[model samples]
Target: MADVNCHKVLMKALDYDERGDKEQAIHYYTMAVELILSIEDKEKREKMNKFARQALDRAEELKGIKKNESPKESGKKSIQTQSASSPTTNAPNKTVPTVPTHSPKLEVTSKEGYTMEEKKVLEKTSTINAKVYVPFMEIDAKERFNFPIPFSDKDGILELSPKQKKEFVQWMRISELCQQPEIIIGTNPDYHAIKQTVVSDCSFVSSLTVAALHEKKFNRRILTSIIYPRNSKDEPVYNQSGKYLIKLYVNGIARKIVIDDYLPVGRHNQLLCSYSNNKNEFWVSVLEKAYMKLMNGYDFPGSNSNIDAYALTGWIPERISIKKNDPDFNGNQVFDRLKEGFHQGRCLITVATGELSDAECDRTGLVSTHAFAVINMAEVDGVKLLMLKNPWSHLRWKGNYSEQDSRWTPELQRILNYDPKMAQSIDNGIFWIDYYSLLNFFDVFYLNWDPELFKYTYCTHKMWQSGIGPVKDAYTIGDNPQFSLAVPQGRGSVYVLLTRHITSIEDFRENKEYITLLVYQHKNGKRIYYPHDPAPYIDGIRINSPHYLCKIRLDPNAARKYTLVVSQYEKTTTIFYTLRAYCREPFELKSLDTYLTTNLQVTGEWNSSNSTAGGCQNHKTYRNNPLYKVTLANDGNLAVELRAPKVFQVGLELTVKELDDSSLTAPFISKTTDNFRSGFCVLDLENLSAGKYLIRPSTFLPNQEAPFFLKLKSSAKLQIEKEQ
Candidate 1:
């Protein structure tokens, strides 16, 4: 009976696999394969071995990894291959949105990237976060928005001096022509309302797309975020209001965008910015313009869509990574977490393929290295589906669940809330794919979390002085821009996110600095380090480390202070940052802002003049080491540490010689054994009285010469310097 059940399940899985619901099929197939292989009798195992192995391979397909053959699959398994790699491009010289006009539409034939069932290719489809409302911050409109535009006519909308023409063409009011034209903050904002234009602000559009997906979750509040205070019938009203205001968070700071009703009109009264597909709709256009002005004109050099999502919806944008080769990849767990985030109104998930150029996207049948919003997830007839939308509203996935997929039955369609009339069109850019297909094709996931989930509070515009942190904080690489927090041992939970402000310098669009956030506890006068915990729960690392975060959990009686330090891999460039802490109750957060330790800190750098200078263990050039002298006026706890990049092999040695011992090789009072030989070396000493000690920095390998930095901190006033 057990054997018969396994066979029946495997058959059901195989049938679903043939039809396209890979997620559910994979689940059932995995169960059957596991059971079939578990048989004790060789005869029984042998009989099912062929199909079991095939199911094993197909099971991987569910996770979006390699796909070879399916159990009893016939002919060529019609799965469209992704596009070939393309050369990635940054903005023109790094700070401009350099997008050429979009090319004319081509006749998208089934043969293009639709390498799968002809019917599936025929189906074209479609498809951060932030804490927002705190005490409302009011900005002086006159001081902040100095640029003013007059409402106008014939020559378009607002008057712009020719000098500013490149940034903006002209602006017209919503009521310029229509006697009572008003911006509609729709009762329900749909994904169809958003379509990416010729700009490379996909990050911006993708984030917005995701937010639109959840507009209803927050009572459809995000859609009409920007409003004219003096409106009617509870809807946005327009009485030639002259100017409108939109509140957006930029790098943690909330700035109000005041705009004249004038619309930016291009060559023939064509609205230039992002406009809703509905010609009469002006919300998206106005919102985009406000965003453009907020970002210092439409000169977007490209940005993390999560960041845009934050500005738009005040939600925290977190990134999720799923490495196909990672041994620990669990599809079910990932889906479950995403589902929870969605239902709890905690996240808006987005996905992207590997970076590809326009040409590459065309050749491979993939959208141009773009981002997609996950609008829906459903399970029908045990078949799981993921509905995604392309921001461009064209060029969709050519794999399973495509517009022409023959699986769109009225029953399945109804389960997915499918619109039959809308489904008939291949250009809608909205489409569905099984979880397996999504995992297999897409590699990156952006989760823009709702701030409500954490009761988030933030401190924006925190400057991290380069010399003030890492290199200068202490010889310890982890002693940079830090803060201390306390959770009442068993408090609910806490999450902290640190975001580096995107630099506006023409040369530094992406993160010019590589930084990490580490949290440690200073207990019983000893430091405990957690290299990688809490990350699994927090926002974690995003596309890059520009925005990194972690969560914290405390133990009973362990309600001690946890110190969070932000340091860099390279450890040099300075950056301005924002720290947002989320917790059930108010977080006991305090900055490590220049305390007494700041006065006791000292840093010195030394380069190997010769291999003999910093003696090596094998070479025993002990006398040939660079020496540092420390003089403590009073008893002080002393810490000495050394650091060098990956390129160098170095070490630090300890030998307490009397301060007055002038001899180069004066017999050492106490010498280090094996503890100090490392790239990042530290020698922490306890209960030292006011006295002098000598420290040496050495290379662990013979004949090694590399520049290294050393940090010395003491409780008592002290002087430190390279020994002569």
Candidate 2:
């Protein structure tokens, strides 16, 4: 009943405040608080506290604004303020509300009267609600997590009580006043057998340690390390001769501390005062105190469970099934424990691998761990030398110029701080390379890989002047009587300098994808692909049609031979071809070999039996049917001959088509010109790169005034053969 009444009063207050009725809002706020005090149920305490906070906020706002009015508006504003200050301001004294009382403070003292000043503790309004008062002194607990302070010496231990922990935690949260502390956990193994047998003794531990040792005149730093005795002869050895480089972790940061059998003269088999020692008693004691505080299910700084730093860093990999060799042991119990630790991000495991080779390591010059190899970039005896240690800790790189040697130069002596003569190099005896050298080496090698690629295109003068200048061209070839193609002129000029001489060709045409012609002129074989000297002439060409619209690759060696086979399911159409021979002076082909032929057997001949190079020959009188064929001899010279073909006209036609950006069609060469050939026409095809394109050609029948759809039985194929 009380909670319901409190809720109703709060809702009414909210409505009054939203409607700008300040006096009504105050009346509702006071009613809500009064209703909350009437509730006896513990569960209703939270509701009461919420109502109290709202009422207090409204009162504070109203009081603060009361004196902020001008003299002109004071008359009206003062009356409004007084009416809003209290719910029953207009009522008699009998209707006045009672104000809530503040909580009382607690005091404590020992029997001997050694009393500390009464530190006023914060009040607890409910089980989960409390207030924490600020302390007079400020202390730093940096890098310390789950730390515990000694309470035995203090006579009045109010701060050590469970109530104090809760109140202080709440106060810290509400006021955002608490500082974070660092935590450290460690694990290791100790030798417990006579012969140090396998799995003789080992244990793991996790704890929170003191960040720094605080004393009157000194502050000492304690680092954490996990150590294990390892054998050198073990396969894929981690350590040999019970010596290992202990992995040290400080505040989640990782470092390595070398541990071996060597110690001060008389100390044997005992951990020295080095950083790798197993003295973690201080941390263990602190954890026990913190664990006690956590037992009551309270969430204070020292009472909460902690997570190791390594776990948060995601160093642990995947888990594996455990196996055990001992008959007395349960199935894989040890492995299960280790696996749990790994999954919980508690274990920090380092994989052992061999050092990368000089080339494998890249430009960084970084050396990987191979059990005992040292890759310090520090200087020794004025010379930078990599120090490697054998896992046995007995054998080292103690050679001629070693740290203890006398043959070292002044630079080397200064680096190693060792001298057979005067020891001028020994300052503090710390190993170090020149700072600049170390920086340069690290920056060059350690940086990640990032790279880019660039491309360029070139053309020739004749190709540009012919209106083809490296652009798309359409040619036709097939069983049709005539094949034609048209090439469009490009904006750029392709000068003769682009192709002064033939070099070598890089091409592939066996597959339908990525067929291109690669022509390169190499001077010193610097950028050349072929080893042999090029013949300084064009070599191989393969294209869709028998016309000149095709790419040619130059073969540095000899006359190139290429086979063009088009496939349809299980069948193939073969088209064998060769280029005409040109003059020795670089001009187009000229000679009697270009014309009539008497004997079909003989190949290279001018004005004789087997020639098909320069001019067109009539097949009706000279041989019933003639075919112009280009062939290459075994001696590397090109030849031409005329043979009989099944069809009358063996040449293709060149057609040109153009379209504007708006798709408005332009006239083709056939529509605008009359000097066009029927059977075969010279195609101006110098402009074309590798990309998809559409070609539309329109034609008509002869003697027709108006043109009609002139479709020809034609097909097209693309080929680019590399020069041999």
Candidate 3:
């Protein structure tokens, strides 16, 4: 039976391979390989494994070829060799530029008249055309139809709390509720028709509302672009096959999300999910269902609209907190920036209210801890006013510029281009409020900017484990993930965005991780020895949000290299993150791997018997610390780092002296860290001659028992051993 199953899967792989569907071919080949390898009989397994392995290898090879082929070569046959004959031509043979096999040699000339060598150095330092990484392939939707509701077993329905589950009910399809169901009701999506229901996804609904408004105002497809199975006009249509595909930018890539038409329905057919006001329209409900499925169902523990907008459209997310005690909170400047960006169609804005008291909520006619979409911004008669929409499509702000406000007049209405009588007729949740009232009421401003505003973009995905670095990084940042950014000598700006990958719903509830980005002005991409040894160029405030944006302006005359450090507070779990950089000018961004070609590491411990835990230079037993002799075969830059438990302060010192020398005087070529730091410290020696040197690793207190790691990195061949 297993052999027959393997043969069937192999046949499917061959069929897909012949049809040029590399993704499916690889999938079936992988299944066949797994099945063949699982056979208990060794002889049978070996016989089938050979064929399965060959098929899998061919499928992987096809995938690689497809990945390397450019879009222009889509329909053309892939050339296996470059030696094939070329068409005869009468034109003179043109010189074909030679491509470098390794790191390509850049021919960029600086306008500052730098020499050839200087240009090469500049090119090497600048990260032009850096590779953008997609950490994983698009996720399989894993759709299931075991039940009429058609819910995926992998992404089960929301596990609501005991109290909430009592009110919950079963799921129903759109066709069962409406006689004539349509994906969209009209030519344009009606922002006013969107309504949030029982699901605790107000932020996501608000995101959809503002996104719909953008599509209506600009006559462009933003929400509809992600939905699959479109008609001839490229508009999303109802799928009779009961399946849909949504492309959402999650983790580090735009992943495909497959869902069915079923939606949660409560008693009396009161849709238990967000939906469009038009009874016949299903796009709003379908889109919400797809997103909620990605988030593990309708029992969403709320998020901000900027995050949702980013997932829907790969935009840059930014959040500005408005606080009474914040000295740097400039309300006017924020409004002006939002006004310019929004009107230019480069920004999507949303505002959220902080936790308000019951009295405050009732008096102001605002919901507590709710998100509102910012639809319009206008300055009329020096009164800065913004138009906002509530996802509920009913309750609105009862402020100065509201519908029944006393400040409304014919002249003022004409200036603002708003009709009070028309607006007062229906409570559509859309209302205008003064800038002062907004600042006083709202606590946060969420902005999602179009990434197309910049030309060059790069992304890198990385993982940081909790045990690898200190839990609280207050004193030293040696274990933090660092990157080197080489900016060109020109006037431009760079934006670095850090996005944390969330793997579960619990990540949205308590958010234990607080992360931020720090930039330092270091030369030659050297590792930072101390936190404040070199003051940070841009010190960012740590926030728990999934996205953090760091913006830096480039000085045309300053040094071209800078270091970006990722810092976290009280890290408790491993985190996978993506660092995406966007800039108008080309620059180089690469991970800082400072380990030299020749590396050596050893582990030792401080004990009372050895008296090797000599305190810093101030201790009497300083000379009893662990000593090692380092022998260099050639001149090279050497780095020595001492690492110990966070409970102890560690330092390293290098001196050119005999291992048996008992002289208390310091050697002429001695190099040491200025201060002992908790966890780790390093000393860098440059242009050292080929010779032997003595290194001392010490703790802050003598007789402190703890294990420590000594690392030696050099550009040339070097050897290190314990010196008795």
Best candidate per TM-score, number?
Answer: 3
Writing each residue's lDDT as its tens digit, candidate 2 over 223-275 gives 12122222232111122132223322211112222222221111222211111
Give the number of the best model, judged by lDDT: 3
lDDT of predicted model 1? 0.56
Query: In model 2, which runs have C-alpha deviations exceeding 4 angstroms?
Result: 1-384, 388-395, 408-415, 418-724
2 against 3, candidate with superior TM-score = 3
Model 3 residue 141 CA deviation (Å) reads 13
Better of 1 and 2 by TM-score: 1
Q: What is the TM-score of candidate 2? A: 0.17
User: Can you write out model 1's per-residue Cα lDDT over 563-645, one digit (the tens) per residue?
Assistant: 77765654455566667677655446766543325133333333344434444544556667777777777665666666542
lDDT of 3 by residue, 60-120 (tens): 5565645345546654334231111221232113211100011112222222333453334
lDDT of 2: 0.24
Error of 3 at 422 (Å): 2.2
Decreasing lDDT order of the candidates: 3, 1, 2
- Looking at model 2, report the run of 10 residues with the lowest lDDT sum: 446-455
Positional deviation of residue 606's Cα in model 2 after best superposition, in angstroms: 34
Model 2, C-alpha of 27: deviation from truth (Å): 93
